[model samples]
Target chain A: MARVHDMGGLPNQGRIVMDKDEHPFHADWEARMWGMNEAMWGPDSWTLDWWRYVRELIQRDDYLTRPYFDQWMQVYAAMMVDSGVATVAEIASGKSDGSRPKGAVLMHAADVAKAAATTRDFRRPADQKPAFTPGDKVHTKTLGEGFHTRLPSYLMNKTGIVHAHRGNHLLPDAGAKGAEVAQHLYTITFAGADLWPGEGRDKDRFNADLWESYLERA
Target chain B: MSSSYDPKKITEIHEHLHSELPSDPALRVKALESLLVEKGMVDSAAIDAWVDLYAEEIGPKRGARVVAKSWTDPTFRARLLADGTAAISEFGYQGHATGHIVAVENTPGVHNLVVCTLCSCYPFALLGMSPGWYKSQEYRARAVRDPRGVLKEFGVSVGDEVEVRVWDSTAELRYLVVPERPAGTEGLSEDQLAALVTRNSMIGTDRVLKKAG
Candidate 1:
């Protein structure tokens, strides 16, 4: 198998586990403060070289004192501050007026009204009936490989049934950022044995939420 | 497989993922961070209006439904094995896979589990949101290390002769495991079969069909 990182080697490093070291707070207090989600955020994708150098300066052993999400936040702040992307002062101040970028907020509300009209609302009536309907056979497109979607890479170009047709959605992708992203998303399902015959359960299957733009019925 | 990444590479990639944001960074950051806070992430709600315009939505209570159908429908099962995405839609759920979306079957002699060694990769359509456990290092580690041991904790224990396989989900496509039916479930409707197959079963933590003594 062409292992993504370690592939399927050591479960501790590779598989998802919540144990001692895996604990965000369990690492060196310094490491924790530096914001290393360890498994959650791998150095492979991000050029940790910047964060790595700065983190090493701390001589204290990594600390084990918090949860995974907390560590993620710490890292987010650290990066903006460390890279001059945002300064430590900015993180402390929580505003970007002149020097720092303002931090974002997350809230729980079903209504758009809950969203202050003041906040920039990017949502448009992006819903569109899928070109393919339920039962329609479709194929994911693998056209080239520049950043263009939020669909998992593993599902591209593969053929499967149209499991669902959720209304319009946005593509959470690097290039698809901003008003330029495709609007709606779709959910596609697949069988277990189909992917890994030996490993899959003959009885079970899976599906995903894909934007209409992601499909091309087979 | 361990990431070939050094710290430098890791940070670089993250910065890229961060910069990839197209929304107003000020607002987007605030939104994501807000969710973090709500989830007890850190303490920062400097900004609001954080939800995504196009929120990803997956079906709830449907993953098992599809599994149940396949268990009872041989033709559908054949189609699913041949083309998972299409098969799933036949019952009204959509699936997407690229490069290679592999399916691992959960059974009496075999058990299958899925995880994103890369990040929090999951098939949202059928399974809805991935449970916190699926995203935790605890699950990833145990599933690969001692699947049997982990399953026991999840209330599932396979035979010594049974084989277990774990899938490492990727950005390319997500993976899901089909769990076998419970014993007393025989003669039950497909809907009934689907009901018995919990998300845990698909993940290989628990097998289907076990009655309390």
Candidate 2:
């Protein structure tokens, strides 16, 4: 979906705030949200891409206005309800009405050691040859809305040259839908003039890691 | 030295938003956790441990060590610039959000900065969690559009002669900027050099300042 979250080079975004001494989690709730997010992401739980899709499902107005962690909290609460872990009444009442879902693993304290040891690897050996190699000119295919996509709205249909072939990795689009499909990834470099002609310097360049499905020959 | 929001302004915004919610954020989070625990849905201890791991054990120190070692070891530097995942793993910092690491060097003529304009996708295993300003909407929207301008606000003044390369982290590959080592520190040990490497420098927002005598 081309939501407000994909705001890369839009105008009037104001200046980047220089918070020299800022903490990662501004408030206690933010820390709790972070911890919960980590705890919920186990082998049996939702993938990061799935969580991102849940976040993208938030109403556009709230998605745009809420603070960073607030957005996380909102999406998490919604997921809890959507996945049947909790209900609307349970969250609003600040108490569980004894209607919790089953088979969630619970993520007990004993499980922390095992969970911490788990590692996620995106690479998968494949026989398919990479479509684009280093120095290959390519253009990103314009994609339609209504699905989880890693292709940024700013770079859609834009032309770029392949800078490097980053080995095959699980496609995020498939990962979001609970399926893992290995695809070639590349670091494509776009001229600053192409992304933002007058705003950016001519010498400057922007690079993005794009999957094979999102690219085609120029 | 510069901040777009002051405490007073933040307090005002908090108060305005506070009126809409039933309780404070801290208390609300506590309540939510308690409710989840009451129903045997979550383990509070696990949450605490997870937070501690990020806050204490994993951090930019790991990244600083990698930078410092690369500065002194030519072969390691070459491997790091070539295959960052395998190179960084020499220090035992790999796996989890580190699918395909790419180390971009900051040379005399070019500078590299990393950002996930769509969301906050960072190398958590190596750098721990991201900073607050990194995930801010303002930073996400403006970093790619005007990197030098953003860097200047962070007190990082890149010269007009140099080129700025902004890496928009759109995929699973994580990027780390090997900032140019400051001069006048030829005699310093690797540990001392690592001390000079700041998290902001690796993120390409600021440079490693010279060691003060």
Candidate 3:
């Protein structure tokens, strides 16, 4: 089943409004939320993949209706309680009951700049040969339900050519489950006509970075 | 929390209960921050530091500088296209949201556009926070299917002869489009050229740059 977050290629979305002078955050709380998110990044905290999975797990109605930061706020709350750092009661009342989670790595104020400047390397040493290389024809596998995947549903079962081999990177499917499984990533290029049929233009194409597990020999 | 505890259900209940009362996101965020701080899980100072860093130091200007240098220097342009991460690191702009960068250049016959269909995954370390419209559902859904239509709405009209290549950021790799330098800017300095590069042009939503007067 296609989750609400998988919104690519859907029809009748709306018009695009370009607000040239728009600020990144409209309110103070939004900025706080953004900072809070960045501050929570650490080894002991939830992985980015898990955070995205939780965001997708939000109920469809709330997912669609809530503001972007508000949705992130909900995800953070859920993750905090789920990880045992706090409780729903504690969150509701805005007070801790004197019980702190042990072994939680906290990001101190001094480490903020280093943390922001440092990039988390997701690439891992390759364990096996890459299944396909650039210029090879491949088809995306039909992803099964009930797991976090980076393969967008719109490209399922679609044939494309491997544009580039992106080396071994952590697969988000396993990363979301708290495991660090690495796989060969590829930039797959699909013709616009193949992806959208009669509605797509002939002079256009789409490229997506897909994992090896999400593709098969075509 | 028990083995049977469901976070999704709890979130639903919380939303349902909150609906009966006045809903204020600002208050909720404040409450969450206080709770996290009280529990010693997060630091407010760290949060403030992050907010200040993005607000003051990082943004599209960093990306503009990279693009401007690439426009004037063929060697830098080649390096940027060959390895975006290494080329960008020369400017000390390599950081979060830019782990494995792939810089695609826009030529006379090809135009490059970037979008994350699943989520709002952008080159935030270099480009700063994504715009509201870039994160909207409208752009995500239509960018992959109707590139011409979306570009037109952004006031960019790609000729039929040009092939529009939309990069869907589905994995960890981030894409940056090096837009073609606009015409009649041969006399401009690198700094002046950087000033003319807008954020939308880097995102491939705008094809035309502001002419230097």
Candidate 4:
């Protein structure tokens, strides 16, 4: 089934609210939610792909209606329970049972500054040559059944030109399963009309970063 | 306490009480935080630090500074277009969500807009936290399909000769649209130029300088 998160090209989405004085957080709780999500980061943290996949698993109605940070709160609670870092009852009651898993290292307040400053490099050493190059015409493949994929449904089975070869990076399909697999990535540029026939303008174009696995020679 | 027995007044008081109660999600977040802190799994102070980092230290100002420098320095502009991550690191502004940065330039004949259809992937390290509109369903759904129409709503009208390019951040690479240097700013300093760059311009929703004004 197509996931709710793959929302590109779906119609009837309302007007975007433009506020010049927009701050990142509207309330203290929103800030706390953002901070809590960041504080959970560590060497053994879950892959962002997994985090996104879990979010997509939310029921469609709730997924569409819930505020952004509220969705994050739901996903974080589920992840904590799934990873055995916390219990559902404990979370609901706001009390711990005084039991923690072995080898759990608490993230200290003092180290957060250092952690936030550090850059996380997602690129990995390539194991094979790139399958496509810039200026080459390629067709995006329809993705098979997978719990997580970065390919938006709108771009599937469309023809585009490889604009640039971005070096090997962690494949999110595998990363969501707790495996780190690198694949050649490229910036694929498609004519706007190709993505949406009558709706797109003649001169408009769209670009997406696609893994080699998602494309083939046209 | 006065025994006010009017049914309408009692109903109004009931509605106010319900409205004043914390939302379900908010209460859930508070509960989760309390549980994690009680279990020694996370520090409350650490959470505050994370908030302060984005709220105070980092944001669009960093991107504005880079944009300003790129406008004035030919060497820096070339370096930024060639290798965004490296050029951004030269300013000591490299961090999370900016691992593979791609700087796309806007030209007189071309415009660049960005969206994340699958998720809201942004270069937080450089541009700071994303604006709410950038992550909305309307922008993500329509940016790639009818970009000209979407831009019109943002009050930006691209000419027929100008091509609009929408970058959908589907993978690791994060994009920073280098907006066109506005006209009539030749006498302004780099700092002044940086001040002219708005967050919406960097996100491709608004023009850095309006054509009329």
Best by TM-score: 3
Worst 10 residues of 3 chain B by lDDT: B1-10
- Per-residue alpha-carbon lDDT of candidate 2 for residues B191-212, written as tens digits (9 for 90 to 100): 9999999888889997646674
- Give per-residue lDDT, candidate 1, residue B12: 54
lDDT of 3 by residue, A30-124 (tens): 99999998997533337778778878887777787777898787777777666666666776667788887676567998998888888767799
Candidate 2's displacement at residue B61, Å, is 1.4
Q: Could you arrange the candidates by lDDT from highest to lowest?
A: 3, 4, 2, 1
Residues B1-213 of candidate 4: C-alpha lDDT, one tens digit per residue: 112222233234323322432458788789878987876667898898888899999899999899989999999999999999999999888888887889999999888999999878899988888888888888889888888888999999889999899999999888998999888888888888888888878888876574322
Backbone clash count, each prediction separately: 112, 0, 0, 0
Cα lDDT of model 3 by residue, B80-161, tens digit? 9998889999999989888898999899999999999999999999899999888888999999999999998888898889
Off by over 4 Å in 3: A42-45, B1-22
Winning model by lDDT: 3
Q: Residue B121: error of model 4 in Å?
A: 0.7
Docking class of predicted structure 3 = medium
TM-score of each: 0.47, 0.89, 0.95, 0.92
Cα deviation at B156, candidate 1, in Å, is 2.3
> Which candidate has the highest DockQ of all?
3
Over the stretch A52-136, how does candidate 1's per-residue lDDT look in tens digits? 2222221122112234343344445544444344444344444443532223322333322232221122224755545877887
The TM-score obtained for chain B by all candidates, in the order given, is 0.68, 0.84, 0.90, 0.86
